[model samples]
Target: MGWLQSLFSPLKKLWFRLHSAPKKRRGIYILYEDVKSCPYEDVHVLWSILVESHTLRTKV
Candidate 1:
């Protein structure tokens, strides 16, 4: 019984970690609002670069 208790303790902790929501907020809503308020040309360029790189990687 003692060994079983010890064995399950780590498993229980792992389960809690796996199921728990992230602790910190990413502030995506704030970023989206800011982008909507003042759209930037550089933002579009950066987004296009990111998309192009992603597509290039996937093609390989």
Candidate 2:
């Protein structure tokens, strides 16, 4: 029994090495910065254009 256990000790060590607890402190987070003109400017312009047309146009 002792010899059998000793024979499998290397396998047990290998399994523990493979399934060890993860070290989460070894991670990285990359941040990015961006600068651009607003894309929604067209939405506000369309709303104003529709309002101006509503005032000038005729309705039934």
Candidate 3:
């Protein structure tokens, strides 16, 4: 069992890396800067507005 687990451990890690969400820290600094500059009082509102604008731009 130990040998089987060891043989598959690298494959499991590869699968996880491919399927997982990206690391948040990668873009957290950018998000912090955007939040600092955003005028909306609620961060959720800002996020929705950004999402809407992005969707609109992509659709056009």
Candidate 4:
């Protein structure tokens, strides 16, 4: 009975650590190629619009 408790104590600690650890957060990143009509400026504008739209949608 004592040996069983000792083994389970470590297993219980391992399970607790796995559930309580913080997870890394990540964001979406987009890469675009520069063209005649769609240069870096246009690309960034589109990106901002998309991000803002997503933010608004999520807030509602």
Most lDDT-accurate candidate: 3
Off by over 4 Å in 3: 25-60
- Model 4 C-alpha lDDT per residue in residues 1-60, reported as the tens digit of each score: 999999999999999988996755545433323332465676777777877887898899
Measured by TM-score, the strongest candidate is: 1
Residue pairs of candidate 3 with colliding backbone atoms: none
lDDT of each: 0.72, 0.59, 0.78, 0.70
Candidate 1 per-residue C-alpha lDDT over 1-60 given as tens digits, one digit per residue, 9 for 90 to 100:
999999999999999998998775453333544554567888766656766886788799
lDDT of 1: 0.72
Query: Mind giving the per-residue lDDT tens digits that candidate 3 earns over 5-52?
Result: 999999999999989988667533457667878777898676768868
Q: Report how far off residue 5 is in candidate 3 (Å).
A: 1.3
What ranges in model 4 sit over 4 Å off? Answer: 1-39
Tens-digit per-residue lDDT, 19-39, candidate 2: 999654421111111112335
TM-score of each: 0.49, 0.34, 0.36, 0.41
| Clash list (residue pairs), candidate 1 | none
Q: Give all candidate RMSDs, comma-separated.
A: 4.5, 19.1, 7.2, 7.2
37 in model 1: Cα distance from truth in Å? 5.5
TM-score of 3: 0.36
Q: In model 4, how large is the Cα lDDT of residue 46?
A: 77
- TM-score (C-alpha, index-matched) for candidate 2: 0.34
User: Residue 53 of candidate 1: its Cα lDDT?
Assistant: 84
